[model samples]
Each structure stands twice: as structure tokens, then as C-alpha cells.
Target: MAEGKMLEEKLFSKHLNEEMEVIIYLPKQYSPLYKYPLFIIQDGKDYIRFGKLPKLVDELTGSAQIQKSIFAFLPYKTVEDRRKKYHPDGEQNEAYIRFLAHELVPFLENLIPSFQMAGSRFLMGDSLGASVSLKACLKYPYTFGNAVLHSPFVNDDLMELVKQANPGMLKIFHIIGDQETEVETTNHTIDNFLAPNEALHNLIQEKGFESEFHLFEGGHRWTYWQPFLKPSLKYMLPAHTFDLESMES
Candidate 1:
């Protein structure tokens, strides 16, 4: 398979009042002449190091199993910072959501040749990162049309947001482990990720959004999430035939 390019960069977010680190992945067949879809991932470092996302994308896109796209991984500075931005009730949660929609999206679109339509943009994360991704999509469906959530940290506030959101405005790819009934949280507490995820799935279904929910066998760690990435990407970003000749005109 052809190799894709990875670049490390920093983005200054006015909302967070800080510079955030971003890892960008360009597909092996990437070209500035053709506009491609974009996937923005939370917990950027873990996704690269643990999830092996770049390699997965390389294999999938190289073999035409999924669409050739651009991936932007946003990594938080520290665990506390991650909690502040990713948790639903955290201090910077709202600001972080705004940064993703208002700042990050525009910055990437301007810097790279990407599809500007909402349908072409996607958000992905695991646990709290997944929660934040869902919130961002709920708040700004015009900017993000899809979310890939692996064992999202669901709470009442997030449930309410999903309840109030307009149906069909977004597409979601969600999965949680069947054995996630006793997962430990970052706040030193034990929570049942499975029950809440099931509730969230039912709500999403009732709300009429285009979504898929799965119950995997493992728990909440990357061991489970890493394997699901391929199917998530394939489901959310199906391969599309590009008319290069027409696009160049």
C-alpha cells in the first residue's frame, strides 16, 4: 500500500485562549486538486499511537475499502485539560465545542482542499472525547454532519441534548462494549458505560437520525475501540468515485 503523510502542527484557539496540537494525515493518493472529506478525531495522540488510525486509513484507502480523506487529530495538553474540554460538565466544555465548530473546521478547510459541505465533515472520539464530539455535532450540525463514538461517556445533559436535537441533521456511528458495565472513570468512580450507551442508542433511534449502534464484546479501553475503527470509517465514509476530469475543469 502507498504511504500517507503525517504532519504535526499547532492551532491557536481563541475560545480556549491556547494553542492546541493537531496531527494531520493526508491519504497516500491525496491531491490538492480534488476536494476530499475530513475526519476530526479527539484524543489525537492515543488514536495515532494506540488506535493505529493512520495505518488503518492507509490500508483502507489504498485498497478502496473506504474513501480517501483527510484526518485531523486534536490532542489535549494534559489529562486535566482533557477533562475540562471533553467532559460534559467540565469548565471548558462549551468553549471547546465552539472551537471545534467555529475555529478548527474553518482553519482546516482554508489550509487544505476539503469538501465544504456539512455532509463531508465528521467527528470521532472515545469516552469523554466521544461525548464532546457528540455535543459539538448537536450544537453545530451545520458544520458537522457525522460522529463516530466508541464507548462515549454519556450523561443526562448529553441525553437531553440528543433529545432536543433535530433528527436527520446528523449521522452517527456508535459502539459500546457489552462488558462495560463496570468501567472506571477518570474521576475515580465506577460507571456502567453499557446501560447509558444503550439508552443513548435507543434515543438516537427514536429521534430518527441516520445512525448505527453496536455492542462489542470487550470493555472501554483502546483494545475494543481500535478494532472498531475500520468498520466505523467504512460505515461513515463509503468510497466515492471521483470525477477528476470534471473537477479540474
Candidate 2:
């Protein structure tokens, strides 16, 4: 639980346009002989700070709540650049997706076989990070069968994408706060805290994906996300064979 064996961030340079950076969290049980599933998280830095994912994995896998998996964290730009790339319509959005779908994923897979196609993976993020995860799932439904969205910043374009997805390939876990309001947005014209997220949850369920939406009694903050992260991991990476009691018992 003490932050695992290592936490690293590296610049992933592609031949196309830019040098993207990614953070990797390796579980203590990560091995070369086996392939590990991946959980690619956008808004990488925030996830690390908010979820403390690496440490959580260390503890959970230590206790056998789940299997050893990888966290591919992407640290996007700050300020305008961050919004542009992370938002659905960001100028670099497509390129960013390509970096993951085409370039980064393949690169990592070659290096670590367990980081395979999407079924063995989960896409995740908070807020806009949440929206992009939704987008990526629609984009690569077969490749990505699962998503963990925390307070996604939903919009018309993203809604369209969700509606188009094949229900069987998508399974989502969405959560939002009960008291979320407009103060969370950049435009200041729309308050996205809860309504949009709830709507999205309803729509995804209507479309027939195995999904669950939870509204907690709190505001839009990391404090809420931290406590719920373990469940998300449990849902994302199912335990191979868990028991009512320990083998040692």
C-alpha cells in the first residue's frame, strides 16, 4: 500500500505530431511471463492525486481483491491546452485518441504483452477526463469493454456517441454528486455537476449496456472519488477466483 514499487512518467514521442507524456503504475505482482490488463486514465495527474490509484492497487492486490493490472496515466497539458485536448472538441482531441488507440497502446503492448486489446482494459477519467473515456469507449467498443466515469462533463456530441455504441460491448460505472452546480464549468453558462451525468447514466442504461449510476450526498470533489475508487477497480478488474475466506484459514 505504500505507493507500490515505483511510479513513473515518461514522454511518449510519436512520429506524427507531438510528444505525449504517460504515467505508468506497476503493481508489485506485475510479471513478464504474463500479460496484464490496462486501465488508461486521462487527466492523469488528477487521478494520481485524487485516487491515489497506485497505492490502492498495492493494497487491494496485496489482499486479493483483484488481480495485478496496469494504470496508463496520461498527463495532458495545463490551462487552455488541457481543455482543448481533453474536451470532446479540443483541437488535439483526435490526435490524442490516435496516440492511445494507434500508437501508445501498441507500443506499450509490445513492451508488456498483458496490455492487450480493450477487453482486457478499462478507460477512466474524472469530469472531462470522464467524457473522453466515454468517447474512447464508443470509438473502440470492442477494444474497451469497460469504463469508470466520475462526474463526467457531458455534452451533445458525447451524447450522440453514447447513443451510437453497441450496447453489448460497453459496460459503464458512472457516479455524480447530489449538490453539483454551475460553478464547476468554464463557460459559467451551464451547471454540469449532476443533471448531465444523471442523464447520461439513464441514457446508457436505456441503450442496454450493463451500467450503474450512483449519486452520493456530496459536491464535485476528489474526497468523494477516493473512497469509491476501490469499487471501481473491483468492477473494472474482476478477481479471477475469490473466496469467502482466505486459503490460510
Candidate 2 root-mean-square deviation in Å: 4.1
How many clashing residue pairs are found in candidate 1? 0
Clashes in model 2: which pairs?
35-114, 36-114, 118-143, 182-191
lDDT of each: 0.89, 0.76
Residue 137 lDDT, candidate 1, scale 0-100 = 92
Worst 10 residues of 1 by lDDT: 240-249
Query: In candidate 2, what are the lDDT values of residues 85-199, reduced to their tens digit?
Result: 6788888777676666777777666656564556777889888788878887889776677889988888888888988888888878889988786535644456756777777
Query: Which sections of candidate 1 miss by over 4 Å?
Result: 241-249
> What residue runs in model 2 are displaced by over 4 Å at the alpha carbon?
1-3, 7-16, 187-190, 241-249
**What's the number of clashes in each of the models?**
0, 4
TM-score of predicted structure 2: 0.89
Return the TM-score for each candidate structure: 0.96, 0.89
Give the per-residue lDDT of model 1 (tens digit) for 170-195: 99999999999998888889999999
Q: Which ten residues in a row have the lowest lDDT in candidate 2?
A: 240-249
